[model samples]
Target chain A: MSTLKIEDYDRLRSKLPNRTGGWVPGTAVYCRGYDMMDDLVGRVDFFQSLVLNITGQLPEERFAKWLHAAHICVSWPDPRIWCNQIGAYAAMARATVNAASSFGNLAADSVMYGQGTLPIGTRLIQRLHTQHLNEKKSVEEIVDQEIERKGGKVNIMGFARPLASGDERVVAMRRTAKNLAYQDGAHMQLALAIEELLYNRYSETMNFTGYLCAFMSDLGYSAEQVHRIFALIVVNGVTASFSEEAEKPVDSFLPLRCEDIEYTGPAKRALPDMTDE
Target chain B: MVNRSVKSRKEPFVKKASTNIWQEQPVEHNPYLVEKTHLRGYDFDELTQHCDFTEMFYLLFLGELPNRNQKQLLQLLLVTFISPSPRHPASRSAMSLGGGKTFPQHILPASLGIAGGEYLGGRQVQLCMQLIQDNHQIIPALWLEEQEARLAEADKALLAEGRIIYGFGQQYGEIDPYASLLADKFLGKSFSGPHLTWCAGLVEELKPYCIGWLQTGIVAAVLCDLGFPPHAGAGLFQLIQAPGLLAHGLEAYPKSRTEFPFVRDEDYDIVDT
Candidate 1:
């Protein structure tokens, strides 16, 4: 039997226990102890408010500006990208802008790439950081062990990206970080060491995710927080792709012929008798 | 800059997407227009004329029509879990969005997104399927003994705030009676496989701890018995429960937003952290 009593469930029958703030409808809206109208409206940038809402801690102005730049790096308005392709298709289908953007964001929640990989990438980097710092493991050992764990395939998450050998976004973000006068901390240092080893040995360099996670980790963000912070990092690009297609004629975005899809199933066969089985 | 230049990995992506489930033949006049379509090599016309939705649904996923027992089990399971109760967060989202007169198109996606969460939803089904796949080989009692330490730790958290062991645990401080009821619908059926049987055994072992089969666990077991992979578990669950979600959403679409209770300011307890 459970140790939990009925009181546990009864304690909040009609009540919502909110850690975050809510509105009084007539009075004022509160967000993380700051009055939304009075304190946050014209005071902080949207990125700062976003971080405040997600992490309950207001980020520094420069850090928010760095994040704003980082979002721009990932969200290029290229419909060739998978998530943006969804946006383009949605626009072609005459979906509402909200629908297009929402569907496009959903498409990015994939395990392989885009926003979905943030949590996994964050976890991997955080684990590698712990191994380097707490366990006194060398960067070489960290890289080798990760490769060995993957059966020596050299398919580490941060180092290798799909469809490309090197990530251009990382280069852009590096410039952004430097412009913001941010210095590489412990996690970033460890990441650079790993990236250097991988690049020298296997021609693979760290991706934008690697750099972002390391930078955020140094600022005391957990893996989950990092994931939450960057959930819609690709939304702007998706919306841009959608807007372009929405302005164009319908059904014109990559219209495909019947033969475009290859059917590899069994050849035409008659259906079996329903009663025969 | 790195020693090596940035270049495409030249991954061998297919020129045309291929599928084993559907084939659309083009008309002679226009390649953009489909003349006819076949599903799993069966004529669409013939399938519409002969097969029921359950068989067609099974064929769509499994690439073959279900057997007699499979059809019966699937049909029953579908009826049993047509809607995930109005109290479910997904249903609440649907109702809320519907009543608020948000575009009809946004309702399903919004509700389904909420339905995809890890708690008591499609993700739970996926995890439960994985759990059943991983540990169904061992005897339930022995498996329980092996996991005793983990279970004890989980129990502490469970009392504090419910923790589902993949998909089997308390809901609202009690074992979910409806889960067993749903499981019983297919427990001794001919289509029921070892995964379901093993889960039944596991539930028996879990009686002392008060954790039993959650609805997700039952769905997971049934899907496993039906040979659907773990990745398919979430999507299948969502698809199965979609009708209820859409129906409830549409039902609330025309109603005044005040038809549903909105929590008052007093009820919304903003705790200081």
Candidate 2:
């Protein structure tokens, strides 16, 4: 016998939807729990409303401004960046804008450049901070324990840029945060302490990602929340990359050659005898 | 501590009532702290230690962890649809992204986002699932008049909705053998499911119309057998295929970025405006 009763199932037919507190459907208008169309139609800027939607609360005006800093810093349109390259390829291939943005944003999850490491690092750092306060552990002791916990991979999260020796974006971001009076939170201090310790040991410097995570940690955003927030912040970079490609002629940006591609895999082989030869 | 579940959920749909697939601890601001996943009622903490990734994948979509057999079957399903040929539109999207020597991050969103078409990415299998759910008694048993009538209704409804049948045919009337083989092998092992059995019966019915069951049919059958709701089907396919998409995207990353794919395919005809 079938588990579903046709009568009951028919009465209950509907699409499963993820719930959200940020936006509520209010007939013809949408509500952000504040005001309806009047508040959003032209009153608020896109970035500010976005942050408000993300955290379920509005951030300080300056912090909303600081959110754009990462975009400005990381918005490299060079086809080498994964997100940009996808956009360029779509433009080159005469694919749609939808293809460029979807693929470009998806690329942000790659472990090296995007959302991959930040959340993991944020979680560990948050946990250690909790441990430090609750158990009264020193920074040095906490770093040592964290290093051991991560199996001795000493370069901790919210610190170090593998590509650039001195990440100038850090100075700019810090200044912006300071200007906004959102400075010297415990998470930021801990990040700096960790940065200092790592510098003493491995000479690695903290980059903009590290700073961004530190701010989120200080604001009580959990690792999972950081993942959502980070996606929001870096999407500007994704789009900036996308726009650069879409504007150019198809394949006009860094062209590729088929002949240069070396095949290291097994050469052409015959199919098994299961097929009638 | 034994992780206790607080809620139980089987249906992923909500027609007239409020339905949620994820639930958490009563405490605000500490969802994962004492979280309660709706389907299995597993404490969030316990899931981390006890659940393998394949089990986790099931839990995320179907809202409950799979048993050993279910897990193994799902693992195979995953291995099968994980990627498509590079010639596929989705793969073509990823390859195009890589042509610019871009980061690996950008390929998936483009490839998977708009992957909906006649083949593995289509809504055809989903429509078929709808058909089976609606007319289970008639479809599998060769109830010709009723099945045709029901299919005609569906065809009209689908036409009104501006959609086409996709799962059964990748294109107008073609099905890939590799996909068929994978589905066949999976069906061989996990035979207890009613949905799969019913789908087999439906295949016989479709033969007169010259319709062959495609990979999407196999996927729909397996998913239905596993008790997954209809909405989870397409998202699950994409999740399984993400890695394959990522791999192709990365492969194109280091190659020369100046190459024009469509441009090289055929030179554009210059005409006066």
Candidate 3:
């Protein structure tokens, strides 16, 4: 068998249906592992399925077991989890700004900055900086001052006291800030901006799972071995409503978009037949 | 600050239309996402003990474990943003019904309604919700066909002549980088199988329509997996994007940008000369 090259992988990847754009607007593209398996295992194991489709070789049982076990075991107690989530949200927010900044007719700069900064700023100030405020002053007064300091216009609509207290006010302020972040007539533009932000942030982290699968391949496993590992992980790692149905083992690995399987050691005989252009 | 009243503008023809086009169509619940709540050996409070509220949001909404902080935040933010407003226009509209509204039932539909339009504050959230719903039933191919037909008709009529399509295209005029970025973030993380499959199915079906516009469709599908209602997805969008708009509006406000009264410019012809 011919060894698979990155170029071959890329060529095949290009053939798969690209559906990344259809995600709901404003959703950060962060799929929980359990969720993905629960959704796709019947058709295929996400990692192995992706690998098999990409590399045309099914993984061996032992390799599948090891990979699945490793994924589940390593998945525990990740410290970066929280940071990744907040970072994704921040990234999505930034994407929104990027989308609007590209518009020609609008006052793109001011609109982007004002709308982009205030909601996040309010969140940061409330979550991080509120503790430093004058103790004597009420939370509402602090928020009002902050709004003034930031040169933001405050039109207290219904609840005034809620706006005065920092904690309570942050809630109302953030909501109001979100509402005011757009120009009066730019709904479609703003929607696109938010959607773009969500898409960018989501895509950035989605490849990591594929990367993890590749890591297993680099550890001296063949394509079939990798597929089984993914299947094992899907079978064991995930919790579902219908465990009995989901627990059933599959005959073949389901193909995924990113599959990187490599043989161990140097001078690995590349599969000439498999290397079809 | 310019004195602008926060009161709802009562337009002459703004009566609520009774014909609910979406409601008329009976939506079959995707069995993957929704199910009868059975007592899985684990106690609810005990499960709560091991997880944070944010993680719980992941469990409840997307029906899986929380993979990253941003996912948790997105869920929290949605709940935070979409929580029924006690004094919103809809809430005020509801007051005519009687006393204070209850939980899920009262707020759910009302929130869904609020998320549906342009003038209303929750358009992005509504769009997000609808996109989620759409991803489940309509694969990408069909969706694109529908979108193309709409865009074609709109384009032919010169309706969207200069304007960007509502969910298509971007300001950079390039493929949206964010869509792929987020999808990468979410690819391996676990989620509801049916929902994710439904999303994948959407990606497959919509592939043809999104050849050049692939990023938009992918991002829409990912959001759907995140459990946003297809219709209200846009409203959630507005919440996430509130910052950009706020920045622009505030900056422009200082320069009296908001002061420009709406005027009919006859020179602004629909068909460019």
- Using lDDT as the measure, the top candidate is 1
Give the best candidate by DockQ. 1
| Local lDDT at B247 for model 2 | 83
DockQ of candidate 2, scored on C-alphas against the true complex (2 decimals): 0.02
DockQ value for model 1: 0.64
- How much TM-score does chain B earn in each model? 0.94, 0.71, 0.38
True-vs-predicted CA distance for residue B157, candidate 1, Å: 3.5
Q: Show where candidate 3 strays beyond 4 Å.
A: A1-277, B1-53, B56-125, B131-135, B142-151, B156-168, B192-223, B226-235, B238-273
Alpha carbon lDDT at B215, candidate 1: 83
Worst 10 residues of 2 chain A by lDDT: A268-277
lDDT of 2 by residue, B1-273 (tens): 111111222436433322234443334564224333332444445566656678777766665456667777787778877787786778878888888655555578667764554355635456656655665665565555555765566653232222333344332233345655665676656434777767667656655554556667777777777777766677666666788888888888777866544332113222211
* Regions of model 1 farther than 4 Å from truth: A1-5, B1-5, B155-164
Candidate 1's TM-score reads: 0.96
RMSD of each: 1.9, 22.0, 31.0
Q: Go through the candidates in order and give the clash count of each.
A: 0, 21, 137
lDDT of each: 0.86, 0.62, 0.34
Q: Which prediction has the highest TM-score against the true structure? A: 1
lDDT tens string, model 1, A19-115?
Answer: 7899878988988888899999999999999999998899899998998898888998999999999889989999988887888988888877887
